[model samples]
Target: MVSISNSVKTGITTGTLRRVHHIALNVQDMQASRHFYGTILGLHELKGEEVPKTLIELVAAGKVANFVTPDGTVIDLFGEPELAPPDPDPKRGFTRANHLAFDIAPELFEQAVEVLRENQILIDHGPVTRPTGRGIYFYDPDGFMIEIRCDPMD
Candidate 1:
């Protein structure tokens, strides 16, 4: 494996990339997505600058809704009323392979599972053990796979 330091020395990357600022997802309903991420997931939304009235109007007309997680992760939900939701089956050609994983403490893993269960969110996979730690996979309202891991890669 190429070390980050070695990659930096070789100019593979600038080595200045700090962290991911946010992620965006397309959704069928902004309100439902908001409730899931904000209420069910317990991510605090950052109320920053006021969106322009015109933009707000557009969003109300089924454009989009942008939200930020408590850790500064921005989740953009695009309103696509007609598009079919993503497929959950990984073997399906149309299934989304990319996903987002949040790091959490080992002690909280069970609590997270309970929260997901209470919300009626289906678990896609295990609280399975990995080399790093335990992880569980589930789908969002949009059928986008999400992972909660007790350990993150160093």
Candidate 2:
């Protein structure tokens, strides 16, 4: 984990920044990513009218997309002409900026795991027990790892 300085955590700007607005990731193919995030994961997307005019062209060309999460945060995808290869060996808990995670209702964990298996999505880490609750990990089309888990309340 990257440690934030104590100053940053308690400083004037600490609470000024609200929740995450969005997170942008580079993808190999916009269409495949769309299917993974939208069709499979069932994330609702923002249409052309909601996005910037400049992004309209990229969206039509299947080079860009914006999907809204349950919490109202957005996941923006853009095609990368040249993508770097994944690191063969990564330190534990290090995602190198290509990982995402979200919590689901605890009772639904197993069903979500089943869905991933039925879709032939490879499970990279677990449907194992975490201190927070149950969790599962898998990779997206572009090799970006994603985690769906239960909230701490579970």
Top candidate when judged by TM-score against the true structure: 2
Per-candidate TM-scores read 0.73, 0.80
Task: Give stretches of model 1 more than 4 Å off.
Answer: 1-12, 48-62, 86-96, 152-154
Which ten-residue region of model 2 has the weakest summed lDDT?
Answer: 87-96
- What would the per-residue lDDT of candidate 2 be over residues 61-104, giving only the tens digit for each residue? 77889899989998999888576556533323334574689788
What's the CA RMSD for each of the models?
5.6, 3.8
Model 2 stretches astray by more than 4 angstroms: 1-12, 84-95, 152-154
Model 1, residue 143: what's the lDDT? Answer: 75
Number of clashes found in candidate 2: 0
- Clashing residue pairs in candidate 1, if any? none
Question: Across residues 37-90, which tens digit of lDDT does each residue of candidate 1 receive?
Answer: 888777754443543353576555657666665566667677777666455454
Candidate models: Cα lDDT each: 0.72, 0.80
Worst 10 residues of 1 by lDDT: 45-54
